[model samples]
Structures are given as structure tokens and as C-alpha cells.
Target: MELVSKRAFLQMVSPLIQFKRFRGKINIQRPRLPHFEKAKYLAFTKPWFINPKKDKSQVELCKGFGEKLFEKDKENPFQEIIAQELRRWLTTSRLVVFYHHNPMNAEDEFKAYVMFKKQKMHFKKYGKRTLEMAVGGTPYETILDLYVSHNMTVFSPEPEIKKMLNITKKFPQLVLLAGILEGKLVSKNDLVKYSMIPSLQMAQAGLVQTINSVGSQLVSNLNSHQNTLVSHLSERAKQLEEDK
Candidate 1:
């Protein structure tokens, strides 16, 4: 038997076997295991096997140390813009009605928006923080407490209280809360009373009628004695002429 060179043997077998060259760097570092400061009690049992009281205690244990976990690093640019717009609306609009906005479907909300738009009123919503930023240190600041529970705002150039109330009746989702009207904070009941009040034109007409009635009565009373005296003199002249 003849002993063959290893290189010669490999060269002969290399044609039958193919080798692949790796293109990426090979990582040889060992992965380090994470250190656990305290061991947590992970439940391995089924839901039915878990004790309700113990589960609740475990949940409480997992809670943070009564501190807020997430804090806003900075205000969003859009949020600032919204706050500015809110201030402008509160300042410019003659009527600002705040409502506790109950959830409504898209169709109903669309209808409500259309109804408000037709009346030339604007419906707006903003975050609580945005509202506080906008309303603080302004005349409307008194109403800050009303900015709770999905609150929404409605703005109008005119104090069309009756019209707005009627529109709200059509959409119950917008529960009337409180509003600022003509620079006065008015409650829901006060708004109702205000809606019942007569319009400016009607009130003006009624006032004019009252003044005219008073003037007519005064003229009639002043002319009454003068007319009586004139009638007596005319009768006296007729008697003298008859005698002549």
C-alpha cells in the first residue's frame, strides 16, 4: 500500500466537495445574563388556581411608589396652537357655551356639527391642560372648574341662546353645562331663563308702545279742562246773540 500526501488527497476530493466563504464578521463574545436585584413571584399556575386575594396583593406590589411614571418633557407645538386659539375664541365670541360632551357616533356628531355651522356657531374641543393654559388669568378663568369630563365648547358671535337651546334638544349628547354670556358666567338654569326672555326687537317694540300710551294719556288729560272752558264761552256767546 502506498501512503499518499494529504494535500494531494484533499485536492483530489475538493472537486467533489464545495466550500462556502462567509461574507460577514463572526461574533465570538459570550452573552452576559442580566442580573436580578430581587426575585419576583411569577405566577406559573392556571387562572383558576390563582388566589384572588394574593393576585390583588401581587398587583399592588408591582405598582410604582405612588409616583407618576410618565411626565411630559415639553408641550407639543400643536397643543400650544390649540391653547392660543382657545384664548382667542373665548375673547372674541359673544357667547361661549360649555357642555359635558357625551360620546356619540360619527353620524350623530356630523349632524350636530352641521346644525351648529348653519347657525354660524363653532363647536370646539380641547384638552384640560390646554384649557387651563388658555383660560388662566383671563376674564374666563372663573369657569376653569367646568373643564372636566370630556367638555366641549361652542362659540357664537351672537347670543342666540334660544336657537342654541333648540339645537341642543335635537342632540342630547351635548349636555348643557355652564356658559359665559355677555361677559357673565351663567349656569344652565340661568341660560334657560335667558332663552325665555324676549328678543331685542320685541322688547324695544313693547317699550315704545308703553311710552306712546303714556304720552296719549298725558295729552288727553291736559286738553280735557281747556275743551270744557271753550265750550262754556261758546254757549254764553250764543245766548247773548239770541237776546240781541
Candidate 2:
């Protein structure tokens, strides 16, 4: 074999080396966290059971500390923190909990997260205004309805909770767990039932239709009586004319 100089060999392989380095960097990039647009309800995964504390550093780290720390703390620190956060958020807005076994892959999760962020921004900007424009409710009622609907729109899956009761695999790994409504913790079954119930708008529309139906029937009955009287008078007029 012909002898090759180190400089010549390195120069020949420079492009290949650069390509490998570029690939390494791409591989090392941290996966993006899931973003929830209008995430009226806060959700987390099984990881919450491991470290409930938002600030992981706060857990006192000591030499030889392991499972003992968890054993000593009867309650899960992570779960407590999550619960507290739920309470705070629920006070101002609506909240629900969801659990999933298989999380989305990094790429898909990141895309979903991006979409969520965009939706959240959009809701924040126009949600209130849209609620105000809604018909058949007082200002206070509309405002309250707006908050409820806003939270519903954010958390519930399509084709909306009103339309469908079952939690489908629409979002794949994400499963509906529990919900907090009107400052109460609702079980999964309750949540489902609640979702099945007609929304304020829907219920109102139904009521309006019922009232209109009753009014129409009343008007029809009155018209029938008038028609009968007209027929009777016409017969009487014909009989009198014939006698004359």
C-alpha cells in the first residue's frame, strides 16, 4: 500500500468528521416539554409519583439517602404540590386531571405542545370578548359562562364534550382522569356524566324551542276555533238567504 501523509488523510476525512459532529449535536438536543393550549386543567404523568416537588433541589439530599426519604414522608411530595397547584388554578379557572400510560414520542409531543401554546395564546386574547357577545344571558351570567366555556374549550377533547361523552384515543396516550368543578373534586364517572350534560348554551336553546312550540300550539288552537265560527256563520247566512 502507498504511504499516506497524516495531513492528507485528515483533509480527506474532514467533511465526514464534520458530518458526524453535526449529527451528534442534533441527537443531544433536549426534547421539548408538552405545551397545552388553554390547558384550563393541569396534568402530569407517572413521573409525578417519583418527585412531586416542583423544585427537586429542595428535597434534602444526604449521603446514603434513598428509599428511606420516601418512606419517612407518608404523603407523596409531588402529589401534594400538584394538588396545591390544582386548588390555586381552580380558584380562578376550571381544572381537570388526566393520566396516560404511554406518552407521545418526543417529536410528536413537541409539535402538540407548540400547537397548544398557540391555542392558549389565542384563547387569552379573544376568549373573554367572544363570551361577551354570546346571546340570551345577562352580563354576569355571560361572564361566568365565558369562564366555564373557556376552561371547557381548553381541556375537553373534540368534537367537544357536549357532543361526545366517551374519552376516545383522539390524543392517543392522554386519558381523562378526574376533574375539579365548582370547587369540588369530581370522579372520572362524574366527569363523564357532567360532560354528557348539555352545555349552558345548548340547554338554553332547548328551553327556547320548548317555549316556542307551546306558543305555536296555542296559536293553532285559537285559529281552529276562529275557522269553525266562520264556517258556522257562512252556513247561517246561506240558510237565511234561501228562506228570503
Candidate 3:
């Protein structure tokens, strides 16, 4: 076979978004994929995902999720098979994904636009996670963009990966994950460092804003360590004011 079918090719390779290696505050900014919002608007779809009782077809449509009823079937049955077989190739995989399977082929741009709009609604209702972010602009809609201003490529494609390799080519701090991911010996810190973005994104977003625009807040999210840092800084400011 051609390594992977078009379907298998897309499905087998799980795109890893945040791998945890990017710890510490070295002043990395929020990720801004070029025209990400527009791409999301394009390939996004609101799949009418249903938690079927006996319907394998319905379950498989869910992308390996939902309460399954049939032994021969599973959540998102088609993808389940694809995921299971690809387990060998996707050994270091975190999230198995399919980004280009369009059951509803568009006849024209107008209809395609309509489908895209619906997909966005579905994505919003379902709520995206780090996994979805890892998969680029969601499946069958757009491929992952390898361009990241921050030299992180846990979720980027081959081209971007090359760039990442080139930049970290000489840095010992940046360990080679490609070998370890392929069952070669390597340090755990290397993996952890790559997975660092999700936490940082969560923290920085917390500092700058909330899920619901201004006024509302969610302070409890900060871990004990981060909380102590903020608290200490506040206390120090208060002491300085008193001394003055």
C-alpha cells in the first residue's frame, strides 16, 4: 500500500498540539495561525453527532466517541478501524485524527460555504479541546498550518517540523523527540518540554482575559505555585507602599 490510504494517511497520523516541553516563561506570545479564523469558517462543520442506542452507523459518525452498543462496531466506526490499525505507526501518537473526509461533497462554493457555517456551529456547541487545536483547522476542512511564530511544532506538519529541526539543530536543551518517539532512547524532559504550550496558553489567557469577554473572571484556575507568585507580588507592592 502507499504507506496509508488517503483516508488512513489523514487518520493514522495523530497531530500532537501541546506536548509539554515548552515550560517556563520565556515570553512566548499567543499562537496566531495565519487566517485561522477564516479556515475554521471554511472546513468547520456541525456534524449532527447523536448518541445512538443501537445504530453503529450513528456511533461511527461520532469519531470514536459515544456509548457503543454493537461488538462489531464502535464510535465513528470507520475511523475506529483506521485508528486501531494505525496504532503501530502512530506509536508515540497522542490524538488520532482525520481532517479531510467530506461525506457531503460540495456541488458549488455556495453550498460548501453553507456546510462550513454549520460545522462551525457544531464545533462551538461541542467545544474544542487541545486535541482539536492539535489537528489544525478540524478534519476535511483544512490541513494543519505548520507556520508558528513561536518555534513550536508539536502540531505542525513536516515542512514546519523541518524548520523546527533547523532552529534547534545545535541546542542541547532541545532534545530530539523524533528518535524517542520512534522507540529510541531519550529523556522524558524532552517530551515534557514540548507539551508545555497548553499550560502556558491557559495561564496567559487567564491573566489577560476570560472565556466571556470583560468583567467576568476565573481566578481559581491558577495552580498553587502560580497563585503564590501573583500573591507574593501583590504583597510586595503593598509593603512598598506602606514603607513610602
Candidate 4:
């Protein structure tokens, strides 16, 4: 201790001095993680306008919106959350866009929106740009039926969506813009016609009914022939007995 150099003493006590200074006085505040609140607010507040120059297609538009909603980082936590939601909608639901030509008053719009929400459907307005609606499919059931004979799947629009469409028809102001079915973009006319097509379950039931009717008619025809044959045989036997 008597031979201790000033620099050596200071170095040895530096750690202790720093520890004492920090003890019972140190507080840490972690930096807040990035979030999608701003992005989401912008999405909800703004309409999704089509820019022919920038947005070449709906797929491109969706991707761009997704990028803007989340961060560009490959492992961003907020991005993952957004990706999950987008995947769920894209896979499990049918997306449709409608043009709201006649703007509804706040009250009517609220009532209509609430009604749709009660049916497990939600619509978002992109101001005058586009109105998007997502109609979720039934749980644990295939929304479309595949035809093995034709190697094609039938387009069975969800009944809930059809009901909404019917409602919109009555409104006259809300017009169908386009629909995404089985990853294909369809025009409004096609969507409306598709909705009119019988669902898979209904088509199957109709087929079964027709088959049963045909089988029943065939059985009745066979029984009538058997009865006539027996009658003819009985008449011949009676004639033989009388002649004997």
C-alpha cells in the first residue's frame, strides 16, 4: 500500500467507485419496440387507390401495403404479426372489393356495418378508393367442392357473402367491384353469376334426388312387367284346365 502508484490505485478502485455510484440509484428504460400502429391507422384512414403506374396488379398492391404496414427487417416481430393476419385472410376467406357510389350517412352505414359484422364478415372503406370485404369460410368444411370427373373444383361462394350481396343489391348505391375466388380475380358479373350457382352441398343433394327417382321408376317398371307375366301365365293354365 505504501508503494502503490497513483494510476494503479485509481484503476483498482475505479470499479468499486462506479459500483457505489450506481448502487440503489441505477434505473434502466428499454427503448420501445417498433409497432404497426401508424401503418394500421393510415390503412384504415386512407382509401386504397389504384395507381396504374405504381401498382401493376392487386398482388403487387397487397405486397406493397404489407411492406408499408410492417418493417423491412427480415425478422421484425411486428412484421410477423401482420403476416399471420394476412395469411389467415388470404387462405381462409374470400376477398371482395365494392364501389360505394352512394355514400351512406353515418347512421345507416353503422347499422349496415354492424349487421355485416354480426355475420362474421367485416368491411373496410378506403375512402372513395375501394371498399374491401372479407367473408370467412365455414370452419372445418371445404368452401368449394372438387369434381373428380372434370378435374376441376366448383366455385361455391359463401352463403353469408351471397346474402350480403343480395343486401347490397337492394341498396343500389353499393356495387360489386370485383372478387377473388380460388386465387383468381373475377369481375363483378362473374362474381354475381358465381354466387347464383348452386353450392356443392345443394348440387350433391340434387344429384342424389335424381338418382333415387330414376331407381324408383326402374323398380316400378320391373314390378309391372312381372305382374303382367304372372297374369298371362295364370290365364293360360286356367284355359288348359277348362279344356281338360
Top model by TM-score, which number? 1
Q: How do all the candidates rank in terms of TM-score, highest first?
A: 1, 4, 2, 3
Give candidates' CA RMSD values in order.
13.7, 23.8, 40.4, 23.5
The C-alpha stretches of model 3 lying farther than 4 A from their native spots are 1-74, 91-164, 167-179, 185-244
- Tens digits of lDDT, candidate 1, 1-244: 2455654565543456767668655555964443453222223332455564573675576565433556444768888888999898888899999999999998998898889999999988787889888888887787778876888789999999999999999988899999989988999999999999999999999999999999999999999999999999999999999999
Report the poorest 10 consecutive residues by lDDT, candidate 4. Answer: 146-155
Ranking by lDDT: 1, 4, 2, 3
- Assess candidate 4 and give its TM-score to the true structure: 0.46
User: How well is each residue in 1-244 modelled by candidate 3, as lDDT tens digits?
Assistant: 6655655744566787975556655545874454978868756763666665555665467755543433353246555444443333234333211122123323432343343333321101111222233333433122223121111113221112223344333333333333233333234355445445355556888877765544343445446679899899999999999999
Alpha carbon lDDT at 97, candidate 1: 97
All candidates' lDDT scores? 0.85, 0.48, 0.39, 0.55
lDDT of 4 by residue, 1-244 (tens): 6566754655543443433664455345764443689768767888676657673777776887787888643554654555445435546565534443465667776766666666666654421101011222333122222111111111122444476676566555455555566666666788777778887889999999999999999999989989999999999999999999
Candidate 1 TM-score versus the reference: 0.62
Report how far residue 78 has shifted in candidate 4, in Å. 10
Question: Which structure is stronger by lDDT: 2 or 3?
Answer: 2
Winner on lDDT (1 vs 3): 1
Per-residue C-alpha lDDT of model 2 across residues 161-231, encoded as one tens digit per residue: 33222333445654445444554556668867777777788899999999999999999998998999999
Pick the winner on TM-score between candidates 2 and 3.
2
Residue 52 in candidate 3, Cα distance off native in Å: 27
